[model samples]
Target: MPQRRRNNRVAVSGATGFIGRALSNFLESNGYEVIRLKRQHFKSKKSQLRTLLKGCSVVINLAGAPIAARKWTPNYKKEILNSRINTTGVLVDAIKEMEPKPELFISASAVGIYDSYEVHDEFSTSYATDFLGTVCQAWEAEACKVQRIKDVRLCIVRLGVVLGNEGGAFPKMLRPFKLGLGAKLGDGHQVFPYIHLNDVLNAFWYIIQHETSSGIYNLVAPQMLSNLEITEAIKQRTKKSILPVIPEKILRMLLGEGANALLIGQKVVPDRLEKDGFTFEFPTIEAVLDDLIC
Candidate 1:
């Protein structure tokens, strides 16, 4: 059985970002008392952070700088890595001190941990060593520390590209296609691992509701998609012509190491979530374009 209504408080870091705002709204609408954890909270002393978390039933860490926001300069790459690991490290400390620790801690990660062009599930052991991969590895490593706290379950969600019209890469992605200028990226073979934004929110809710739902989960749609298929779908849906293919060499020059993120993708699936009976709201690219583009 779940706890009393008074104990239904939840603290969420990164409560200002795209996914965070959506989740905060969802939880509040469902009667959850949400305490938004901010960057300033992580900067304070560990005990100070704990006071903010008092009486909370859950703590979700989605606090991090945008991945593809800027070119991955050596200094900027450091910023990306520290943003995730540092916020997560502080949360781990604060959670360690909670007398009645939150029932669960779900930290945000990414599918970039797996090598590009390979199929992966929660059980895949073949990890990548690139900048994005190492960042996720370190980010999850910090969250893993919470497993040491007795009775508090730890869940790390490896997110793919979350598709929504309002925010994330989806809106920017649509602009080019809408103008009839969309093109195949790289060799047009990289997988486009993605999921609907609503499903991302529900996946978090599902974990909180299911007591036995613990450990890592790939919060991606089950269908494996490639760049060509996605491009063709967008073209057909919008009744637009395909633009000239953008050479990977040009992309690499423009984005630096960040191009790897755009040109390579993991074939990830939400295996654990499906086995646990979670249903996806949007599972196919066509369904996604239909709901989003129309």
Candidate 2:
């Protein structure tokens, strides 16, 4: 697969998702043709999918169930794991049958792959043993199958808490702050590894532009911040005073295991990305909130 053979055409599996929609627009603005691979496309015959994938230079797999969508019942736990593993499996199987597989296959993972106990880089093996960590591990493992496909390079991005205005965690947090109900989660000591949505779009384009880029990359900002700091940043923008901490017990009770997504987070940094010369547009919580709230 020669570089630029496809004329910058790309296929994305989770086009309807928050990140996916943002990424698609970014790609198109950069003069690349974007193909939205909806859920139905994954369910259809592989031959049909192969048709859609024709001439695509890259295939991005961002298709996964939202980790914090609901309380994690035992069945819902299965839903999280299956949504990631199954969709990646289906996409990989289809790519294998292609006469000329895409030049690159990029998959989405999360910082939750690491346990809350340690600061991690891309090489750390300190994996989390909890359900969220387990799902993230399995998600990357399934995505790794793309490595076996000849001519297809795999790039896995372990994302941090994404902050943006269009959609995602920021908008949800904004409503409470606007209502003067903003409060820190748990003890507010947990590190909130976060990145802006614009940087995410640029990172994908960076991977596409850097043909040699492959393997796992921790997609986070250079600055490390605590949940309390993020709350303070938001408060500065919304002119809301801080409320008392929301006890961990209360979140756990409401979200069950799902509260871990908010109450617990890893201190992850973008070591590999910076080492590769990729720079973030918004590197701190202050910058992120300024862009979204101002």
Candidate 3:
């Protein structure tokens, strides 16, 4: 493998978010200068955004409103789309105007873009028509605009559920299982694609370091598990008895449209990532659970 340039500058939007915070720390610790771009910067003026991004070798855009943060009301849904698309649009436009453009442009997408049933890889064309799927599609579309710029390697990472000790769904998941109320969500048939926090950071760093690494890549573990499979894994790890399954109707009633996130999921695999030789620190749900639990 080629050695990364010492002091290679990288500008990252959404640096305060869960993945962004971790990524920024990882880059800095590895001798890369990371500039955190705020939403306010994009809202200010293009010149300011350009000035902030200028001279950086890599640009990572992860700006998006939290989908699971609140009820998916009409206004909140609009906020989610606008946050991702608008921020990405600003970055893409700024990249176009940059003198010496960043070598690599990496943006975020979600596996929710794929339909619920069957396995999906980078090559699969089937996409969901729901709210999240539409959001992911539009987010990627804005990111694809960077391709028009000459010599810029564009990589769109379709993220799976990110599991980590801090900040992600992992912390919330621990609450139920810890209380011995661990149970499958919905029918437990929907395949959930997930990745460890370590792998997520490594994938971003891997793409930036390897000049040839570009295009859409699924940032997920090779082992795709159904909800029942994951629940069982948690049960084994915690040594706790499983409770009754939570019905989809209950989740829907509580979360509204956001329940689709838990009820419907894609069986996404990181084929390109593995083919590219990126190793996972936590390859299986068992491994992930053990690391985080016992």
TM-score of 3: 0.97
Scored by lDDT, the top model is: 3
Which residue pairs collide, candidate 2?
Answer: none
Local distance difference test, per candidate?
0.89, 0.89, 0.90
Per-residue lDDT tens digits for candidate 2, residues 129-226, read 99888899989999998888888989999999887888888888888889888899999999999999999988988888888899999999999989
Judge candidate 2 against the unseen true structure and give its global Cα lDDT, from 0 to 1: 0.89
Best prediction by TM-score? 3
- TM-score to true structure, per model: 0.96, 0.96, 0.97
Clashing pairs in 3: none
- Provide C-alpha RMSD values for all models, in order: 1.5, 1.8, 1.2
Off by over 4 Å in 2: 1-6
How well does candidate 3 score on lDDT at residue 124?
Answer: 91
Residue-level error in angstroms, candidate 1, position 274: 1.1
Off by over 4 Å in 1: 1-6
RMSD of 1: 1.5
Q: Model 3, stretches more than 4 Å misplaced?
A: 3-7
Q: Candidate 3 lDDT, tens digit per residue, 43-159?
A: 897898888887998899999998787788899899999999999999999999998888889999999999987688899989999999999999999999999999888999999
Residue 126 error, candidate 1, Å: 0.4
**What range of 10 consecutive residues in model 1 has the weakest lDDT sum?**
1-10
